[model samples]
Target: MRARVHVLVKRALSVVLSLTLLATINFSAHITSAEAKTRKPTIAEINEAKKKEAEKKAAADKAKAQLNAASNQLKVLTAKAVAARNRYLQELKKLEIATKKAEIARKKEEAANKKSNAAQVAVVSSKNHIGKVAANAYIMGSGFTDFDSILHADGPQDLMDRLSTLDAVGENNSSILLRLKVAEESARLAKIEAEEARVEAVAARKEQADATARVAAAKKEADQARAAQEVEVKKLQQMQDKLIAELLSARKKRVTLEQQRQLAILEEALAARAEQTDVKAKVWPVNGIGFSKGRTTIRSTESIRTNAVAFAKKQVIARKPYVWGNEGPNSFDCSGLVYAAYRSAGLGYPEWDRVNSRIYYSWTKRIPLNELQPGDLLYYSYKADISTIHHITIYAGNGMMWEAHNTRKGLLYSSIYSIPGLIPFGGRV
Candidate 1:
């Protein structure tokens, strides 16, 4: 019995040893896997990373190219829209002038017809009077020829009176004939005048109709062009948004790889550029009219100008929305914002209130680009002419500008030099 128990105990110990060896083997395998995961990547893996980076860069380049193409397309469309709108306005003016001419022609036609009718009536009346005179003369022809007045006379005075009446009737009949002749000529001339007036009225009406049609067609074209431009603008905005997202992603990755000190300097520069402060009584870095020693020489206009700039900057900081033709506390267009800012600053353009960018262009005095000062009105034209000026913004100091840029950008501060279609001159209100 003792020998059997010893063999069984040895078998149990062998089983326990087998279990311990298996646990050691599993722990060693886990350690090997952990070390493999923590090890640096191989050259092949580094090459794969580089390939991915190159692919991302290629995608970025392609997107940038697409953005540029879309921006150019937008410029073309904007020009088309502006031209269509101008054509429509011109047609409206022509329509107004034609309508006035038609009205005048209509009045002239009425007056001419009335005069012609009166002259014709006179001609008929004169003919009837002549007929009555001829009938009386025929009825009394034999009696009058046989010395009837002398035969019917009672005394010398009576005979003389009868003879005078006879002579007066003869003269009266002759005068009626002459008047009738004159009336006939007058009626004929009046008829010609009436016909000429009728022709003029008809022509004026035709011109008015043609003008109306042109105005309608012009308005339709303008609407279509505006709609197309709006659609392109939306598409351009989407592309820009996507590009910004991709840029942000790439920037985040770069920031992760860049040194901490370098990142700090970059952030600092960005922050400094974005900083806004009051300019009241401060030395502005400007040289031009009303400026002396980097300070405003004219205090009378200085306060007003600075106030306008302040008002515009406040809206920009508030991120006001851009709305076409809007002048408000909520939203504004480029010219609307400028008008409102100046109006709020007590430098109101009463005569030119709510006018377009072109009108604003005329209201300002030209200053060279190098002499730009804060609160100066900046103008831009696609055709580089005053008549085609389409955009206006207030100049903020340090080469920056405040503008209600567009639907996609809203009210924002931007580098004046970087924008497209910049005129080399600015305006001082």
Candidate 2:
């Protein structure tokens, strides 16, 4: 009875399994029928898509170029502002010197004024002294001479002594007048010096005013220059920020379009294969898990350490400018980009050159054509020899590769094996 029950359970499980298989088959058929009903895109449709994509790329490139121009302009404006500020400082220094000279002149004028007042006082005192001497002589000399005639002297000797004393008094009066004249001359000289000092003080005050005006003008110019520079810098910054965002958006769109293109290519290839072989269309895995090429089912792991790291680095640097020999950050050359990509994965592949390109091949394992994986380097050359390889790129699978292509194209993605060169094989590091 136990055996019979076990048999019944086994039959029930088999029936359930059969039903699940039927459902899966029905689902597959439905998908195939849906696909069959749809037609491939026409040439016109493809051309229109290409045109739209081209327009977007052109706009993005134009924006990038404008941003570079704005950056250069900002540098120039900054220099001009600095020069203006320097000139302003120099003007300010000149004004300071002028002001100091004016102050010195004013002090000199004040001293001259004091000297002039003293000179005026001396002239007045000298004139009054002359007048007093003259008055005394007139009164005494006239009255005493008249008395000489009215009152007779006791003897000739007394009369002679009186005339002689009168003559001595007249001589003293003449000496007083001479001293007064000298005082008047000194006072006049002092007055002349005082006038000159007053004129000098006026000139100095005017100079100070001019210096102050110059300082104001220089400060105004410097402020204007700084304001202009700030305005332009802010404008350029905003424009550059906008352009950079557009650039990134363009790159993201390109990535999406590239994905769609890869899918379309795969579908076309699979459809053609189905028509020729008369078999169910299968979705073949390129970089994802569970890739079965034939009898061998290759179950790729969910993640590859080197591949993840290297591809992540490439994505970070995508759409950068292609400089002649630059290696990273903002620009790169062809081989330089490849070296960077692997280095980002912690592989540290050296830069590839005509001589070192061959050396690179030696460092990596030669992968089979069917076993090509992401992070593998695809080498192209003029000849089959590795030494002749002129270009290298990082493989991203699904017929895509990342590279710094040319000066015009910059760092971008491309379809694998589509490039026209002697591609001998792929290498894995």
Candidate 3:
């Protein structure tokens, strides 16, 4: 009975195992049918998908390229904006000079008018005095005419006395006439001077207007450049904030580098100056020749003047403050400093002559850059044009100059290249 029960159990197990195998086969067949329905991609289809991916990457690269171009454009625009601002500042300086010139002309005209009025008064007074003398002679009938003096003689002695009296009267009349003539001549010269001053005043006013217009134009250009730069900055920022920040940082670095270069130039100039002999006169170089230091054993008149000018400059170098239009003992401007130096050297206009940089530039005899000497004037211009000259300083030999640079900088002993807009030629007074 146990064997029969075991065989029956084994047969039941066998039947269960066969059914499990059949169910596994049916599940495999369903999986294979599903895989068959989901077919592998074709070569053409794969290539098409890859092409779409490449196009997507290319579009992304194109956008990146455009953004980079915009970044560069932003940098260029910022540079242009800075340049435009510099130009505007230069124009403003010109306007200030023109306005000052107009003011000077007006003052001169007023003074000339006053002189003319005084001259006219003198002329009238002289005429009235002469008329009074003639009227007194006619009314008193005391030798009023030569014919009367000859006719009213009583004796030889009386005739001689009458003739002497007529001679005295004639001398008085001649003196009065001479005074009237001098007064009239003075009035004529005064009128001429007044007219000339009036014409100068008119011309100065017109120049002021022209300068103002140029300033306006420069300001407009600066404004436009600033607006364009701002717009570019905004666009760049919107595209990528990091990129614009980097661009700005780069610009700042360049500026810092430029400042460093300027400082280096100053240092080099100082070093050169130190190597030079203090008491010796420097023979200025012209075309790479004659840059020698001469001893004071023999000094020419020109050398003495140069020394005086240099001394004057040294007296105010760091001692005086920079004032916008000042030209004096305690403070100075750029042109004012040079003016004061030359005046001290007895080579410039009077103390009351407060001319601007443009006037000073006009008075200069332009010499080559290599021919600059001590006491020579250094003129600076905007865009290297003589017409836009705005600053003046004195060359202090050895590639150095003395200037009342600005309010913040005050007076400085600086290198020739320390300032911007240096012209290739220097001015000889």
lDDT of 1 at 348: 46
Candidate 2 global Cα RMSD:
13.7
The alpha-carbon RMSD values of the candidates against the true structure, listed in the order shown, are 29.8, 13.7, 41.9
- The C-alpha TM-scores of every prediction are 0.41, 0.43, 0.39
Q: Mind giving the per-residue lDDT tens digits that candidate 1 earns over 295-320?
A: 22222277888999989988876779
lDDT of 3 by residue, 1-429 (tens): 234323533555666546534543443233222211113344555455555555555555555677677768767766766776676677667667766766766676676667657666766776787778778887877556767867777878988997898788678767766766766676567667666766765776676667667766766776786687678657655655554454455555544454444445555545454344221111111211111111223212476458656755565533678889887778888877776776676654342266877666556566655566777777765533455667888877656677888888788876555555555556676
Q: Which candidate is the best by TM-score?
A: 2
Residue pairs clashing in model 3 are: none
Candidate 3 wrongly placed segments (more than 4 Å) = 1-60, 141-143, 240-429
lDDT of 2 by residue, 148-227 (tens): 63366667787777777767766765665565566556556655665566566566657656655766676576667667
Question: What lDDT score goes with residue 293 in model 1?
Answer: 14
Pairs of colliding residues, candidate 1: none
Preferred candidate (TM-score higher): 2 or 3: 2
Total colliding residue pairs, candidate 1: 0
